[model samples]
Target: MNTETGVTAQTRPSATSSEGPDAHSAPPTRGQMWRHLGPGIVVAATGVGAGDLVATLIAGSRFGYALLWAAVVGCIVKIALSEGSARYHLATGSTILAGWRSLGKWTSWYFGVYVIIWGFIYGATAMSATALPLTALFPELPLRAWAIIAGIFGFVFVWFNRYETFEIVMKILVGLMFIIMVGLAFLVAPSLPDMARGMTFELPEGSLFYTLGLIGGVGGTITTAAYGYWTQAKGWRGMPWFPMMRVDNALAYIVTGIFVIAMLIVGAELLYSAGIALEDSDKGLLGLSGVLEERFGATIATLFLVGFAATSLSSLLGVWQGMSLFFSDWWYQLRGASEGGHEGSGAYKFYLAWLTFPPMILLFADRPFLLVIIYGAFGALFMPFLAVTLLMLNNSERVPAHARNGVVANLTLAGSAILFVVLAVQQVARLLS
Candidate 1:
């Protein structure tokens, strides 16, 4: 992995060298799998936060497997969008923030405003989501207490560890959640015919909103923009690393797509089959855990809850780390200090603090509605911001000819932009209403 320029360096053999022993060496082994699996894990873990789970469960409960296809499509959209961002970083040797900054100062201003508003709102949401399971398991503690603990824990982890340690921890959490959640899906034995029909992509009656949400919700967020930073941390840069980066990204989302679909299967088979409807909150997950306990016994249910907790915790940590990095860069650029001694400065810690602490005010506020609304509005717009920008940046002359956006890439990104705009409109309407 080359870290100098953001582009991945190519490793393809020349046509004449294809027949050599080096070229014919045995294929990469299982042990080598770990090397290529890093970025995917981070992307998936970041994308599959608590909000995604709630959306999937709600869709399953309302329409069974009808929306599974949308979930898969969402994963494809994410791969295209995230890959585009990563490719830009790998090809340009610059951060996404730098790319956006190059476009114009307005790009920087929009991101700055969005991140501050988004982080404060998201901090409370992530803490509350993590607190739900903890409060359920230990009813003696207040939810506020649990939320504070979760927030502080996330803050400590991101503050203490550097990128490498953070990646390893998140990978473990992702593995645990993937195994338990997917394992539970198999145990419930989903209906193949129903799943196949879902693959056909027809929207069921009264499910237009659900379908849109599923398409917009699958493993996506502001964290998608963080792909380049993570790639830099992995020492991956230049076009030589492009093949491996693509493979890493594709495999990551493949796992994420499977994980989300498996959850939908669980919802369809376990909850929907039993006529269970989950609420639009993390508490809904606790209710589902109760159903799991009743059907599969206490042990399986406990495992599922643990996985749920890990997912929420990992997300908390990820947002704290990734968003802080984004905010710090934007802040420095805002001060017109694009170069000099301020590059890669220590300002990220301040943003991390902002994410962890200020939101606690909402945890105890008399009314939390305004905070939630502001958060949702900004959060809704971020995907479109990323998609539209990537389309513009990757196709611009700033990128080298070899790495410029081709027709297929442009089409995919355009579709993503359209889809995200629709979702963002719906989200705003919901907030205003």
Candidate 2:
């Protein structure tokens, strides 16, 4: 029978059948389909935040399909990492923060400090990204005004909806984003030779930044840790749910991987061929849209902008909700508060406000140089944090031996950790210089 996690259901035989209880049965109902398809969508929606889209588009424009290999590598890393997080929850029935607490106080403190700073900086970034498309669509409204509106709208969406409703909305937005953006990829014919070469596993000259960026952007983010929370939200608890969770995480990142590859194709075929350079900011997307209009038509350009808006705004909503959950859970643990009753408590609303309002200040003034440095530096550190943590946590005694990392997983995690440390060192050195 189909389960709540939206994985492909395997059949189990009825009691009367000689084939055994885990054999064939009738197919699952449509209702079961909706129930099972949740955590993947939540994780996917969170992973594709605006910064990721910008990074992917830029990588495509610069290196064409040469960096598509990085995107594929990124997807594999995220799946490995996310599966580790979800598996921890299903195996131990504890939140990742709680699991970290089990390890030591230092773990808790590290996460606390990281989350607060990350949320503050990310709030401003997400708001600004969301506002860019709105400003372009209706130039009558200033960018700052649109940013406030987007923030408030995100706040309200998270403030009222339960987890299920939130997932539904996110899935719809993700659907629209996939159709419009990925559709453009097919319309622009790609070079089979170049795409094949990209898959050959060789890095091109002076392409380190682009390669590292694709690796970093492939659905890696702070919200990744929040996968445990989404797992809980979907009522996926205990080892019995582990298979479904694996399927959910895999399918989500696979979709993300395909979406990213499509964007790279668009970059290879359209921007790189035309000698167009994408701007460094969200406005760069607008410039790209204009290019699409010139090459295609206004209809295609407007659709691309709409897809951009959906991607950015959906990410804002997800970060606001997911991080808020992460923060509130951390606060409750620190205060020795009771569990299972904090869902929509004051702590949750407090973080929701934290993500929505204060950062708006940056929209008016120049995003302070020091703040940018701190954000970029710490942001660069998070993927490694996730990679290393998954290695430690999943391989620990707490995890069942059966569920622990194999040699393949260990090597992949180690590679990802090393890659991020290199990127972080480079980012920090750049900032200091």
Candidate 3:
């Protein structure tokens, strides 16, 4: 029960309240589980922003189907991380922040510093990303103006609404983006034999970085850690919800895999075959739109732009709502508050505003050099931190024996840690250079 709102499951509590139905009843059957898949949809749509699509698309253009296996591998790795976090939540009945607190103060220091710096940098990043397609589609407004509008709209939307409304809107955006992207893929008519060959793991020369990137970049972000919070907001609690949670996660990533493969197909068939090299940024999608217009006429190109906007806005909304939950939980837990911060809480709104307004400055001016370095340094280490901590938390007595990591889970988590560590090193090296 939420003490502030006096909300109970019987009262149909708003998502802003954070308390879900207690796990006193039996779990839903498989037949009934489909409808309970909101959290996964939220995570999937949130994770695959424009940057992720760009990375996969670049890989497809460079290597054709050779690195297709990397995209599939990326989905599997994220499943391990997300499942571990969600399992800790269900098994121990604690937020991930609580789990981190148990490990040591180091976790707190790392996360506290990380989230602040991350939110500031990411706010501008998300806004600019969402604005790119919009600016392309509507040339009357400048990019900076569209960026501010996107940020404000995201802030207002998440601020006023509850998680249920948020989830419904995300579902619609996901369906819109997914259908258009996949439709473009089939319209290009990808070669089955080449894609099949790409399924076998082979890294081409000079492609090591791209291969690692494709493996690491697909739908992996801070939002991945927010999965448990989404599940909690969805009213799932305890071990009884495990089967439903697993289905929710697996299906979501499976869709992510398909969505990624579609982008790769577009890259291979549309860009690579035409010998076109796109600028390597969010604007790359805009460049792709020009190519689309030339070949498939203005209607298809306009549809792609709409899909691009949907993709970017979905990510902005997810981060605004989801990451704020993370910040809220972190803040309250730091104060040793018994009741966790939920959607409508002061801490939640603070982070939401922090993500929305402050970043708008970057849209008008250049990013500060020191801030970029700091952001990169902190951001690079987060995945490794998540992977390593999940290993320690879930394998320890914090989780019940049955919920502990098995051999496969252990291997996958360990591999993820190593992969992230290597990526972190590469990022730091690039920043320093």
Candidate 4:
């Protein structure tokens, strides 16, 4: 029997197709498939924040179509990681943190410290990043003032709403961003032959970190660990939902793949073609805006900025809500409180405050140097942390035998873990250097 959804092995649907045994219902139709696309969209939007765009833009600016293949590989890695995570949720019906607790108590403390530090720093970064396009578009308010306003807006939205409302807002933001990015991509009109050559897997010298960064960082992060919560929030049940999970994940990441590919096209066609170098920060996007103005005029630049705002704000809101759920669950587990109903819990509120208010200090005053160091230290290791943990949980005897990790899943997870480890070490080396 499947432990999470209480369905027997005989009734479990194949992950590839919605089709399953006669005892279970037939696969969901295309309409139903469209409906199941919730949590996946949420995860995708949350993971591909401003920083991810920066990395991809830099990669494209430096190498043009040379590293485009790495972006595709990065999406595949994300699919495998997200599939592993969603599988755990479907097989166990528990949050990832709970699964971690089963692994050992040390995981609890590790995640706690990591989030405590990372959330504080990320909150500041995300808000400021969100404020960038707004400041560019509307210079009426100072950047710091706009950032504080953005932070408060996310805080109020996440604090008062439930997951359903949160998902709706996220979908809207994802839609806006998607339209803008894809539109921008088409405007660039990259060469098809160059893109094909990029697919041939030639990693140029000196672009190894850039390549690895694309593979390791493209649409993958701590937000993935929160994916299970999204699954639960979406109210999917039964072993039969596996195919829907599969479809949902595949389609969502395809959208993410498109978004990344679009940004890369922009990087290659616009900045690279024009020989304009962007600052290796979120401000790089603003620099790109000036390019758009020079080429496509102010209207296109304005549209791009709107899209950028949608993308950054979606990340801020998703992290605000999802990680609050993470801390809330952790608090429940730590305090030995009642199993569920932590939405209004103190820990949830505390983490929300952590994500929202404390970082406002960084908008004005200096960030604590030690806190920044610790954040990068732990943050650097998060992808590998999730990959390794998923490998442990999904391969354990807890999941139904038929539902356990298959060969492809195993290899993918292992590769992701190893790649993330290399990336993490590289990040640490860079930090120390």
Q: What's every prediction's RMSD, in angstroms?
A: 6.5, 7.6, 4.0, 5.2
Backbone clash pairs for candidate 3 read none
Which has the greatest lDDT? Answer: 3
Q: CA lDDT of each candidate?
A: 0.78, 0.77, 0.86, 0.82
TM-score per model over all chains: 0.90, 0.90, 0.94, 0.91
Q: Candidate 3 regions off by >4 Å?
A: 1-26, 338-340, 367-377
Give the higher-lDDT candidate: 1 or 2. 1
Q: On a 0 to 1 TM-score scale, where does candidate 3 land against the true structure?
A: 0.94
Off by over 4 Å in 4: 1-31, 339-341, 366-377
* Residue-level lDDT tens digits of model 3 in 1-433: 3222223222432223545443334678999888678889999999999988888888888888899999999999989999999998888777777778777777888898899989999898889889999999899999999999999999999999888899999999999999999999999999999999998899899888888787777786678899999988887878889999999999989989999999999999998887899877788899999999999999999999999999999999999999999898878767655454788888899999999988787777764555555555667779999999999998998688999999999999999999999988987887787
> Backbone collision count in every prediction?
20, 4, 0, 0
Per-residue lDDT of candidate 4, residues 1-433 (tens digit): 3322333333432211122122144447777677557888999999898888989998888899999989999989999888888788777655566677777789989998888988988998889999999999999998998999999999898888877788899999999999999999999898899888999899888999899889988795888777766766676645677888888888878999999999999999988887889998788899999999999999999999999999999999999988887888777666554343245457777889999888888888664454444555567688898889988989898677887899998999899999999988987887686
Tens digits of lDDT, candidate 2, 1-433: 2222121112321101122111232323444544477778878877886677778888878878888889999889888778878887767655676667766777778888888878888888888888888888889998889889999999998888767788889999999999987898889987888888988777888889878878876685677778877777766656776667777788899889988888889888888887889886667888888999998999998898888899898788888887887887777666664432144768788889988888888777764556666777888877787888888888987778988888998999899899889889988987888
The per-residue C-alpha lDDT of model 1 at residue 288 equals 87
Whole-model lDDT, candidate 4?
A: 0.82
Name the regions of candidate 2 deviating beyond 4 angstroms: 1-35, 339-341, 367-370
lDDT of 4 at 312: 95
Q: Model 4 misses residue 217 by how many Å?
A: 0.9
Indicate the residue-level lDDT of 230 in model 2. Answer: 79
